[model samples]
Target chain A: MVNDSELCEIILQYVKDEYLDEDDDTQIGPDSPLISSGIVDSFSMVSLKTFLERKYKISIPDAKATPEAFDSVNKIVALMKEFF
Target chain B: MAYADKIREAYRKELADIRTAGLFKEERFIHSPQAAEITVEFPSGAPQQAVINLCANNYLGLSSHPEVIRAAHEGLDSRGYGMSSVRFICGTQEIHKELERKLANFLRLDDAILYAACFDANGGVFEPFILTDQDVIIADRLVHASLVDGIRLSKALQESYKHNDMKHLERKLEEFQDKRIRLIVTDGVFSMDGDVAPLDVICALAEKYDAMVLLDDSHATGFMGRTGRGTHEMRGVLGKIDLITTTLGKGLGGASGGCVSGRAELVELCRQRARPYLFSNAIPPVVVAAANKVLELVSSTTERRDKLERNTLYWRKALTEAGLDIKAGESPIVPVMLYNAKLSQDVARDLYKEGIYVVGFFFPVVPKGAARIRTQLSASHETAHLDKAAAAFKKVGEKYGILGLKKDQIIAKFGA
Candidate 1:
């Protein structure tokens, strides 16, 4: 089971790996706003959604696929827990 | 100091609103020259190479053509680099006039005027001619952003119809029937959805309403028609459209330039009045020479166009047969539908890992809940390249549980 902190780490790793930008140190917490902070854009959000679905094998409903669930790694993990 | 802090807070709030809505965009870094296949070297050393390049506007495979390169090299030697002057000044070269003449002849238009880009061409078009409030501009709702921006900058009364909805367009025209001069503007092919406008229908509507039709054929110039003459030729209405604007950056030679081809009078008027042409430096001699060569090649041979058509049909059929949703179009721009943004992104990434280069389109670039992978077929891409891509897609579709089950099973389970 991936915990919120673990999920945050994984999400960060994915961003770092895919974007190849090692300088992004923006923290992902339960209250952090990924999109608002300019850390994630629409494309990155899609990339994150794919990561969550494939890694956790959980279906994220369209209604639930909002910033409330995906704004931060912590929120995403919490949302995944609810779905699970 | 306190006021400045408050302003910063407001800006941050607006950014927060955008973030909350999932509309922000982050640009990808491309370290290599634009080509059919490219290597994007990132900082982390996880090297990825992809095919079926989705993001480029390189419609024809002329960007890196040997003939184009040779012409560019010759121009560089003959003309010697930058002009640093506008066309009316000292910037105009023999090649500029030659390319412009070739473009006009190729499109079978009376004359043509060159610009720094298609955006500039659109930006300069409306403001110069249609300044009166009595004039009307009836534009398609889904026309390119440049056209919208151009319309906004003009004083003309602007109305828009729904995307490709001719009845709505007619209704808009009826509402503005008494206007002095009405212009119906549209994209020859919508870039995102891979859908073509009902150009023939629109042309008839223009004739009935006494409106002038202006088509931005950036996506259709070198790849739409049988002989690659564009939307007018494709629809069998070559002499009917009043104005045609297109980008040389996409299909011509993929260098960097744009042009407007139409009536001799309109072309002359634009040359004298258009700000970009009047103020901006002309296209470098090298690019103009290269573009001339490209037009010559396209006019002489239909082999490249035929190959592109065949490639488009094959990819569309194979992807659809694999049970993937593909937006319908005969053009090279093919959209493989993946409603979930994350799924689309994963598919693109996984495909990249498998050595297939494609990009996923999501919200903002596309509408929300309508994310897709916008794959573009190039005349340069071989059958083997396409086959390998399709095989990889099939493998990834099954691996990601996107399309593994039988059709009936999927329909029964998911209810279509």
Candidate 2:
């Protein structure tokens, strides 16, 4: 079972590798505001939700697939825990 | 919860979420006419100083050209304000036909037909021309929202390749060859990034697959090529596209009209069957007349187009030298990419405070973390205006620390 920090580490790598554009160079922390900081967008969010569902075996219902649900690594870990 | 109440409560939650996410769209109304300089009101109700306008689609600066405005007046006098009827119901005027003829000549197409707007033209195109089960519509993933909606409305099977990926397009074309008809549609110039389509490759692929090509050259039609005949001319595929859709809202006169122009039979088919062309009220005579004047001006001399290209190159260089992460583009639309959404908004606010008017683009307008403020150059923007805008950008960008990679980050990324 993946712990919260491990989950955060995974997400941080995913964001740096996949979501961030070539020109962007912002540092990502557990508390970093992904959406507000413009490190990710709606498409990125959708991709993240899919990643979470696939990797963690936790489905994010459409209602819970919002910024409030996972705008930060901490929030995403918390959301993943709800299913666990 | 009761059914209606639950629905209302769900919608209320969604609205609240949008506000929290900063994705809610906000509008700013301009106080002056569309030009190089205009006044606008901020959301706080404070009157902003006259700003050097850089956000408009006024490519040729004909939005407020004296000649175009006078032509509008002349048109009003000679042809009246409006027809107040659909084209089939006594709305088609002699001026409409004349404008269509001029558009055909301008595009070097065999014929042309006018529509309410390019959006309507896109909406009406696929349904009439290729609405069948075996008819496949292949599009670039980033084609305009209007074209996507049009494709959705048609019964044709839809397939999209990666944006501007010719290899992916070839694969899709090969896979869909078993389909009876394949229609490939793409934008001549994608508006968001100001990137010209690889029209030459697309045309060649169309020939190989025996497919039809449609180019919505809305952003390119006014002043893109050597003689401003749009993407086809720019790409050296002049008069090769099967169908073309373009707008007057941005290019010609900056009023309102659009046309589906191309080969005689294609245009004639659209004129006879396209819903938007048949049901929508005719293009107002004044707008048609103003557009005619704009076309006349464009045809007579390449002066405005030349000036616009020069302006685009100058400021793109200026902004890059100033250390802003400006996208190097050939078109007049230059985007200053700010990865952080809040930073994008903050930078735009600071620029506005410095009397430069540009809007921030975020989220759905572009991919996530790719927020930008698109600045459009016009022939009307003088050197002084360009210098002022660039200076303002430099100032605000420094304050926000948005200019190129910081010294420390640069060292870290590059390894001193």
Docking verdict class for candidate 1? incorrect
Model 2, span B305-387: residue lDDT tens:
89999999999999999998877678888988776667678889888889998988877678765678899988889999999
Residue A45 of model 1: what lDDT?
58
List model 1 lDDT by residue over B309-329, tens digit each. 898899898887887767888
Q: Which ten residues in a row have the lowest lDDT in candidate 2 chain B?
A: B407-416
| DockQ metric, candidate 2 | 0.08
Interface RMSD of 2: 6.6
Candidate 1 achieves a global lDDT of: 0.79
Best by TM-score: 2
